[model samples]
Target: MTPPRVLAVAGSDSCAGAGLQADLKTLASLGCYGMTAVTAVTAQNTRGVSRVMPVPPDMVRAQMEAVLEDIGADAVKIGMLGSPENAEAVGEILGTLKGVPVVLDPVMAAQSGDGLNAEETPRALLAHVMPRVTVMTPNIPEAEKLTGLVVASLDGMEAAARRLVAMGCSNVLLKGGHFGGHDCPDLLFEGETGQLTRFAAPRIETRNDHGTGCTLASALAAYLARGLSLCEAARQAKTYTSGALQGAVSQQLGSGHGPLAHFHSGLL
Candidate 1:
């Protein structure tokens, strides 16, 4: 009867809206115990990221090893690896771990267009981390960056998802929130089944969607840690994200892209 343990490997958000803060909040809200291995420290708010300081590769590895060896997470969510070195370190740590589900939110660019990873980081992730990931969640632009395809339509998103599977990711979730559309559709491509599942939700008309991508990925990791299948995890995560978005309309925290109501579940 123990709660599932979910570890988040990402950056620290000073504004508490995105990155590790959002990951931890989402995990908790989805009924999982949360742990963290910070890869960077950022001075940021809803407006934009002002500065970032990457954590040493050795330190990143040390934190991952310590957490994996001790508390032993049931799942790990990776985000915002600030440098190629950090991504490499994370790849190495994931390689050594066994059985735990890993969800990689290929966070290349921030909500405000701030770049998080270096040019080499995406290649490193594909070469070293994709095979280890249980699922990869990428928005349209990130999908384009990862797969080198123009994701102008849903078909393009599916093609990019298939390419990601070819690149060794077992499952891919191509998010269509960035695309210009009325209905936000997300595609789930299963490598083993070769089936494409679609989840469409009405886009919440709110600017407080800053940490939504991070929240969805973390929620999926939490559910997977709790022994849910990938499809089930995605369903639950989508619902949670929609609810968070809907709840954020009345509570705007920052001047720019505000944060979702992570404490809407009352765990915070």
Candidate 2:
């Protein structure tokens, strides 16, 4: 039998350390079949991003439609669109597939402090894409940018999550890893039911967290494809990322910002 299908609409990472590579790795580890509709192509590595070339809006549309129309998707994970026009294109397509669970990672910057999107990308996501998201995963900085709140603490994180929920997004997972601490806590604010939950994991001290946001969102989507609840998916994804980081703490992957150990099954 074919496995649960998880489609990743994101960018391509040349180093196989982030973007759709991370998504695919997480998906397979979670027993989900992965597909992709690349929105941008990044000249990046464990070090940092050198250049970005966004796929045209029309091409992005074609890629998404091609997968969605054929194999379809049990869940969708969206990452860096890189441009406002591509964001709108995806928004329209996902709007039509409302029943499919969509995990949105508003990737604004790389872990290496490289800027990832155009200035207008976030606005387009907020207006066109966010409302359709089943789970919105944003790091502290992303939450602040998307919600216009000063998220310097956990209380600020809660406030920012609520703000994003109020902005028409379905659920918000405000990630706290960016906040300076050894302990990381992610707050989940569900919009329709007003349910709130927190998933916390101690920070793994390693620069090898390049695609964490992308990995978390993709892992959540993969778990959702397996019929897990939103909270359960988030919790499992958090646990998975924590383990991946812990496993990579000693391994020398790269010079600058490396990648998490996505495969615990020892497959690759």
Candidate 3:
């Protein structure tokens, strides 16, 4: 049997922890074949993103067309579109590829606190991409940015999720890491059904969580590619990420935030 195919449209993180690299690793780990259309290149390590150069819009669109026209994708995961143009390019491709599930991670800020997208990119995403997405995964800050609402508590996160649904997203996963609590809570709002589901896991005490958002979003896309429901995909992704974080706690690779153990399941 052939593995599910997932197309990841995102930026490249040279350290391989987040962005396109992390998405590829997560998809592969979750039993999916990964392909990519890189929107930007970043000089980054586990420590931080030092520099970034965005790929031209034409080149970005060409990569997407080449992959989708040939291999085709069961699912698509989008992240870190460096500019409004890049976001629109990705959105145009999404519009063309009908019936494929799209999981979008609105990655505005990096784990190292670097801004990845321009101020106009978020608005462009709302205008062009959000309506077409099957699911959107955003950390609290990103959610707040997208919705212009404060997410200081779990209730606030839920409100933000609903607002995002109003903004035309089919579903929203509001990640609760920025709440700064002992337990990390994530809220999943199903736009079509008006159902809200919550997933909570103990926050792992580790500094090596640089690519966690990308990992989760990619894992969700991988599971969707394998024909799992959105809720089931999110559940499996949370468990997978928790294990990766715990397994990599002791192996520090960079001076700042480090990479999760992408190969943890193999080591077991």
What's the distance in Å from true for residue 143, model 3? 0.7
- Flag regions of model 2 displaced more than 4 Å: 266-268
| lDDT (tens digit, per residue) of candidate 2 on 1-268 | 8899999999999988889999999998888899999999999888899999999999999999998999999999999999999999999999889578999999999888898899999999998999888989999888888877888888898899899888888899888987777789899999889888988888788878878888889989988998999999899899988888887777787798888889864532
TM-score of 3: 0.98
lDDT of 3 by residue, 131-203 (tens): 8899999999889888999888878988999999998999998889777778889999999999999999998
Weakest lDDT window of 10 consecutive positions for candidate 1 = 259-268
Deviation in angstroms for 144 in model 3? 0.7
Candidate 3's C-alpha runs over 4 A off are none
lDDT of 1 by residue, 1-268 (tens): 7789998999999999899999988988877889999999999999999998999989999999998899899999999888888888899989888898999999987799998777788888888788899999999998898888998988998999999999899999889998767788999999999989999999889989888999999989988998888998898889889889989988869899999997776752
RMSD of candidate 1 to the truth, in angstroms, is 1.3
